[model samples]
Target: MTIHTGHPFADPDPDPARRLRGRVVGAVTLWTAGDRADRTGLTVTSLMVALGPEPRVLALLDPDSDLLAGVRETGRAVVQVLTWGDRQLAEAFAGTAPAPGGPFRQAEFVATSYGPRLATTTTYADVSLVGEREVGWSVEVEATLDAIIVGDDADRPLLHRRGRFHTI
Candidate 1:
């Protein structure tokens, strides 16, 4: 038997791996794909940077999500870093909450070759799908960064850990 240490993201049972990941904080974002009548997106925390001269991007998307379907069909997407004020919008895309005028209404977006990106995003990347594979419960995607847009509020980022939102 092991002694229990009560930490916010700690596991009560044997699955320490998942609980530990819950403690590894991540920036939150809305990952969008397609355009106009075909647009789809989701709140994402599983995005990561692939280091090199030109940094590539990787993300694990739900295999069944509309955003994944759109990305798989169109081979394009937008990764827009969210701000602290975007909790509601994130939740809406996460399907845990509702948005009054749907998720897109919460923020303004502009079209790009990869999809619609948040107009106010301090950092956004337009990506073209380079590769994809089935990984557990997700569709793991590798994408080439086609373009990047940076805005004014670069320091403020929306983050997630312990199953809740935070700011930095």
Candidate 2:
């Protein structure tokens, strides 16, 4: 059977009017230091690339989101790049069925200067929140990278695309 996907067009940044349109893809992680030293996190369906290696990461959070308060109070955050096997961990932190009960006992993790973060799946980086700006439905945060956790087997990455995870 022939599938009909609409016409494909060239992606171009023509002018101011045609600009500002953004595409959504992937499951970039949202993490913060919770009330305790435990890490509080969520899987944001919508994540964006604020800019490149002055290395700023931006996320939009609901005004009353649990993590919104976490970021505001802590002024620091961590972003973990997930692998496919990490779907469960992401779901847990995102408050899915088996929510994070206490300090993420089920998964492997390590204690950091700011908080505890996942030790499984892949890499993580600690970032310091520099500022925030209101943007319609959510707030845009600017953060700087401070520390990085790398593992020997972290070369392969799991990516979320069109609502599923695949090896990359």
Candidate 3:
């Protein structure tokens, strides 16, 4: 059927899967280390693009969460793009992967062009806080671009789809 411009809801959706096939949102792995450095950091799926390229990224954090408090105090955070190999790190932050108390030996971290880079090896952009906005139940933070740490030789990106990490 031909779709008319003036008519509402006239266009037929052809191959809806195409729209969602590769659609990926920011699953910025938040690394929060402070007083309880050993038990810090968390994986949050509430990240979003704030539009434009003014070095601005908006991350939504629960105002009542400990991670949120750390971000507020430090005014900084490292945003790492996840890779398939980094699933353990992501899960640990998500509170599903267990940490064996003391020192937390599951993952190792190294320094890079960005801040402290995680050894699970994901591309990342270290950002510094620029500003914040509070809307009801969430705290949105705007951060400035600091540095970038490229991952290993692999190119596949870890994707968050339907509450789990898939590949794209």
Candidate 4:
């Protein structure tokens, strides 16, 4: 066995689609669902909001993620926008960092009708599942925005790009 350091994807032939996706900067958000004992969350970056008489949220989630399973069972979810300080929490949920006692133990979360929401996140939305379909290697979930809480725009949002976190 050999120990290799540096970037994991050192392959010469990289997928152009994946490279393009890595270039798209997006806000780091956490989507949570289910009850306290069985709650699950995932760090998501591929998401968008559509405004209209009935606003909506669209997110690309891992098809086999526990968060998606929870959402499917409960039909509700909480989407919380993370701040610059929440990078570690994001990593925990993303399964990229060591979370000693599960990801939820990494920070404080408050119980909501939809699910557990990050206590420090002032910007969040409670959504109900509308529909979902297989899109590429992900499950594209469409949800109706049932309620929204906007935070101060002055707060620096945690952004993800090129496999790294950024602040803006």
Candidate 5:
């Protein structure tokens, strides 16, 4: 039987799984939606692209984040892969850095039927929300591919591991 170890909140290592998960490397991305009037977006490293019976984009998104709301209201989003040069933009979207016109100011995007696609990035996808389920503090989203744009920079992608960014 597992024994209780004081209050979960009081413990320093509240979730050892988080530390372990941090060791896993993930590609950095920016998930965005809505228009400039009501635009919202966030940095993400939990995006997974699965190509099987049906192409899908699976991701973990903060329930309270503007991006989530934008997806809900607009029914679409654009997922853009990032490069090492996008580090500052990532921080701004993560809410750890300041951006003058909000996080959207960190980068430019073009309007698409699916949502706002990041203008500078060559690799990005226009997706439509297909399914979703709540997972703890975040929402697990599954989206269907509406359109995909690929460019030459697919080789260079930003990676996150052990709390910092790395690139090949």
Candidate 6:
């Protein structure tokens, strides 16, 4: 296997928008949907939470991702925050690293009403799809927060920026 020691997308002429996005640090989250019989997940960093009478989550998901398909089919999903220790899990879900027997097999998971949640995750949100629209090259998903669990800030949150993982 060819091991790359440098940035994977180190190009002479990179997309300005992608380059700009890379500079914005974001917490890594794993969004999972579907049931035990059929499940799919994706590592997401481009997301935001809006608070109001009804709190909602806004996430930019790949148009063709299985996670997106599962969410559409099930109408519910679990969004769990990943810790620094979950770097490998995040990479596996992101499809940037090899995952033997699939990414779900790489770690322990607990089934919830929405879907499977990482067993080690202390912070997560159960959401139901509110709406969606095509935004840029991605599908912007809007989901209402049905439930939320906030954990104490003991462990560092996994972050992504500049095509690399960081902890803060």
Which candidate leads the pack in lDDT? 6
Q: Give the TM-score of candidate 1.
A: 0.86
Q: Residues 47-166, candidate 2, lDDT per residue (tens digit)?
A: 654555676666666666667677777777667777667777766666664855642765766666655577664567787878888887677777777776666665555555544555
Clashes of 2: 0
Q: Each candidate's lDDT (Cα)? A: 0.86, 0.64, 0.63, 0.96, 0.86, 0.96
**Candidate 1 local lDDT, residue 135:** 82
Candidate 6 residue lDDT tens string, 17-113: 9889999999999999988999999999999999999999999999999999999999999999999999999999999999999999999999988
Q: How would the candidate models be sorted by TM-score, starting from the highest?
A: 4, 6, 5, 1, 2, 3
Clash count, predicted structure 4: 0
lDDT of 5 by residue, 1-168 (tens): 767767744646457888787899999999888876787888999878899877999999998887898999899998999988889999998998888977776677787776677778888888999989998778999999888888896567889997799999
Locate the minimum summed-lDDT window of 10 residues in model 3: 31-40
**TM-score winner among the candidates?**
4
Of 4 and 6, the candidate ahead on TM-score is 4
**Candidate 6 structure lDDT:** 0.96
Tens digits of per-residue lDDT for model 3, 1-168: 976667674446645553463264545464543443423466766676554666566777777766667666766666767667777777777777776752235677654332345665556777777888896578887887676666575667666764568776
Q: Which residue runs of candidate 6 sit more than 4 Å off their true CA positions?
A: 1-9
| Per-prediction TM-score | 0.86, 0.68, 0.67, 0.94, 0.88, 0.93
**For residues 99-144, what per-residue lDDT tens digits would candidate 4 score against the true structure?**
9999999999999889999998999999999999999999999999
User: Per-residue error at 58 for model 2, in Å?
Assistant: 1.7
